[model samples]
Target chain A: SAVISQKPSRDICQRGTSLTIQCQVDSQVTMMFWYRQQPGQSLTLIATANQGSEATYESGFVIDKFPISRPNLTFSTLTVSNMSPEDSSIYLCSVEGQGAEQYFGPGTRLTVT
Target chain B: GESVGLHLPTLSVQEGDNSIINCAYSNSASDYFIWYKQESGKGPQFIIDIRSNMDKRQGQRVTVLLNKTVKHLSLQIAATQPGDSAVYFCAEIVLTGGGNKLTFGTGTQLKVEL
Candidate 1:
C-alpha cells in the first residue's frame, strides 16, 4: 500500500472563495484521482489528474469549478474554484497501485460558509 | 456511465458479531472491485478487493464475495470490534476511453456497539 497525505486537513472558507488541496504520495504512481464526499451522500469522482496534462473531469464537474494539477507521478493538487456552500465536502486523492488496488489520503475537509 | 451501489445505508451490530455489507454494480464489464473503510474525519482506507474472475477472497479477518451473475458484492467482517465502526464503500474499476477509473458507491455505515 502507498502512503498518501493531504495538506490542510481541515479549513473554513467564505463563500465565493477558492481553496487548493494538495496530495502527495510516498512512491511514484501511475493514475491519480480526486474525489468529493458530500455530507450524507456518496463520494463522487471529481477528476483524473494526469501528469503534465490537463485533468479529466467527470460529469457534473467542470474545470471551471474544480481545477486540477499534477506536476509529477507522486504529487497533485485540486483547486475548488468559486466555492459555494454546496461545495463544502471532503476532498480525497487516490492512487491505484500495481495490483489495481487504490490507496487514499486522509482527505481535506472543506467547509464553505 | 456505470455506477456501484449498496443495499443498506446503515448497519448496527454488537461487538464480536459478524457483519456483512452488500453492494451492487451496474456494469458487467467492470473486472475489479474494492472495499474501503472510512472513519469520521478521515479518508477511506483500503480493506480488501476481489477480481471479477474470483468468487471469494479472504484477508486476515475479512472476506469479500463477488457475484457477477447478479452484479453483487459483499464484504464480511468476522468478530467485529469498535474499531470496525465506520462507513464502508464499494468501488468498481471501469475501463473507459481515458483508462481504468474507479466509480464509488454511496457507502454503508457500520456501527458496532460495545
Candidate 2:
C-alpha cells in the first residue's frame, strides 16, 4: 500500500470556472490513475497520468475536460476545466500496488454551483 | 456493454454476527477482482482480492469467494463490528493501454447495529 494525499479536500466552484486538484504519493510508482465518483454512482475511471507525457483518457472522458499532469513519479495534478453542476463529484487518485491492487487517496469533494 | 453488479443495495447486521456481501460481474475475461470499503467522506480502502484461478481467499476476519462459472463474488465478514459499517464495492481489473483499470460494481451499504 502507498500513502496518498490530495489537496483542497473539499471545494466549491462556480460554473465555467476551473479547479485543479493535487495528488501526492509517498513513493515512486509506475502507474497512477484518476477516477470520478458521482452522487449515488459507482466510480468511473477518468484518465491515466503518464509521467512527462500526455495522459491516457478513458472513453467518454477527454483531455480538454479533465487535463492531467504528472511532472514526476510522486506527484500529479488533475484540472477540471469549465466546471458545471453535472461535474460535481468526488475525484480520487490511486496508484497501482502489488499485483493488480490499487491504493486510493482520500478524494477531493468538488461541488460546482 | 458488460458491467459489474451487486445483489443487494443495503444490508443490516448485528454486532458479533456474520455478514455477507455479494457481487456479480458480467465480463468473463476479467481475471482479477478486489473488494473495497468506503467510509463516509473517505476513499475506498482495499480489503482483499482474489484471482480468477482461485475460488476462495481469506484475510483478517474477511473472506472473498469467487465462482468463475457463475461469475459471482462474495465477501464474508466474521463478527461484524460498528467500524465495519460502510459501503462495500467489488471491482474487476481489465488490462488497458495505460495500465490495469478497475471497473467497480454498484456499492452495497452495510450497517452494523450493536
Candidate 3:
C-alpha cells in the first residue's frame, strides 16, 4: 500500500481560471495516473504521467486542457487549464505498485463558479 | 476503444446481510480486473482482483467472481456493516495495447442500513 496525498483537497474557483493540483507519493513508483470523477459519475483516466517524459492523455482529453508534469518518481502535478463550469469534478492521482494494484491519493475536489 | 460497465446503479442491503455488485466488460482481451471502493469525499480504495484465468478470488469478507464466457464480474461482501456503504467500481486492465492502463466502469452505490 502507498500513502498518497494531494494538495488543495477542496477548492472553489472562478470560470476561466486555472488550478494546479499536486500529488505526492511516499515512495518511488513506476507509473502515475490522473483521473477525473464527475458528480454521480465514474472515474475517467485523464492521463499517465511518466517521470522525465511527456504525459499520455486519453481520448477526449488533451494536454492543453489538462496539462501534466512529472518532475520525479514521487511527485507529479495536473493543471486544469482554462477551467469551466463543466470542468468541476474530483481529480485523483494514483500509482501502481508491486502487485499491479493501484493506490489513489485523497483527491482534489474542484468547484468552478 | 474499450469500456467496462456495471449492471446496477444502486444496491441496498441490511446490516449483517450480504451484498453483491455486478459488472460487465466489452473487451475479452483484458486479462486483469480489479474492484474498488470509494466513499464520499475520498479516493478509491482497492478491494480485490481476479485474473482472467481464475473464476473466483476471495479477500477479507469479500469475494470476486468472474464469468469470462459472458464477460461478467461480480463482487460479494459478507456480513455487511454500516461503514461498508460506498460506491463500488470495477476496472479492467488490457495488458496488450497500453502498459497497465485501467478502464473503469460505471459505479454501483451500496447502501448498508442498520
Candidate 4:
C-alpha cells in the first residue's frame, strides 16, 4: 500500500468560488485517481490523473468542472471550479498499488455554502 | 447491492458476533471485485478482493464470497468489534479508457453494538 496525503483536510467555500485539493504520495505511481463521495452516498470516480498529461475523466464529469493536474508521478491536484451546494462532497485521492489494489488518502471534506 | 433511497442500508451487529454484508453487481463481464470499509471523515480502506475465477477469499478476520451466477458477493467478518463500525462497500472493476475504474455499490452501514 502507498502512503497518500491530501491538503486542506476540510474546507468551506462560498458558491461560485473555487478550491484546489492536493494529493501527494510517498512514492511514484502510474495510476492516480480522484473520487467524490456525496452525503450519505457511495463513492463515484471523477477522473484519473495521468502524470504529465491531461487527466481522463469519467462520464458526467468534465475537465472544466473538475480540472486535474499531475505534474509528477507522486503528486496531483484537483480543482473544483465554480463550486455550488451540489458540489459539496468529500474528495478523495487514491493510487494503484502493485497488485492493482488501491490505497486512499484521508480525503478532503468540502462544504459549498 | 443497489438502493434508490437517499439513506443507506444499515446492519446492526453485537460485539463479538459475526456480521455479513451482501452486494449485487451489474456488469457480468467484470472480472475483479473489492471490498472497502469507510469510517466517518475517512477514505475507503481496502479490506479484501477477489477475482471472477475465484469463489472465496479470506483476510485476517474477513472473508469474501463471490457467486458469479447471481452476480452477487458477500463480506463476512468474524468476532465483530467496535472498531469495525463503519460503512462497507463492494466495488466491481470495469475496463475504461482511463484503465480500470471501480463501480461501487450503494454500501451498507455496519453499526457494532457494545
Q: Please give, for residues B3-109, the per-residue lDDT of candidate 1 as tens digits.
A: 12234388999999999999989889998999999887778888998888999999989999999999999999999999998889899986554546888887998
Q: Show where candidate 4 strays beyond 4 Å.
A: B1-6, B95-98
Tens-place lDDT per residue, model 4, A1-113, is: 88999999989999999999999999998889999988889889999888878899989999999999999989999999999999988899999866556789999989999
Winner of 3 and 4 under lDDT:
4
**Model 3, span B6-96: residue lDDT tens:** 3338799999999999999889998899999988778999999888999999999999999999999999999999999888999998774
Residue-level error in angstroms, candidate 3, position B26? 1.4
Clashes within 3 Å, all models in order = 0, 0, 0, 0
> Could you tell me which 10 consecutive residues in candidate 2 chain B have the lowest summed lDDT?
B1-10
Worst 10 residues of 1 chain A by lDDT: A37-46
lDDT of 2 by residue, B11-109 (tens): 999999999999999899998999999888889999999998899999999999999999999999999999998889999986665689999998898
lDDT of 3 by residue, A30-107 (tens): 689999988778889999988989999999999999999999999999999999999988899999967656899989
Off by over 4 Å in 3: B1-8, B96-98
Per-candidate TM-score against the hidden true structure: 0.93, 0.95, 0.95, 0.95
TM-score of chain A of each: 0.96, 0.98, 0.98, 0.98
Model 4 lDDT vs. the true structure? 0.90
Judging by DockQ against the true structure, name the best candidate. Answer: 4
Interface RMSD of 3: 5.3
State how far residue B83 of model 3 sits from its true place (Å): 1.2
Q: How well does candidate 3 reproduce the true complex, by DockQ?
A: 0.46
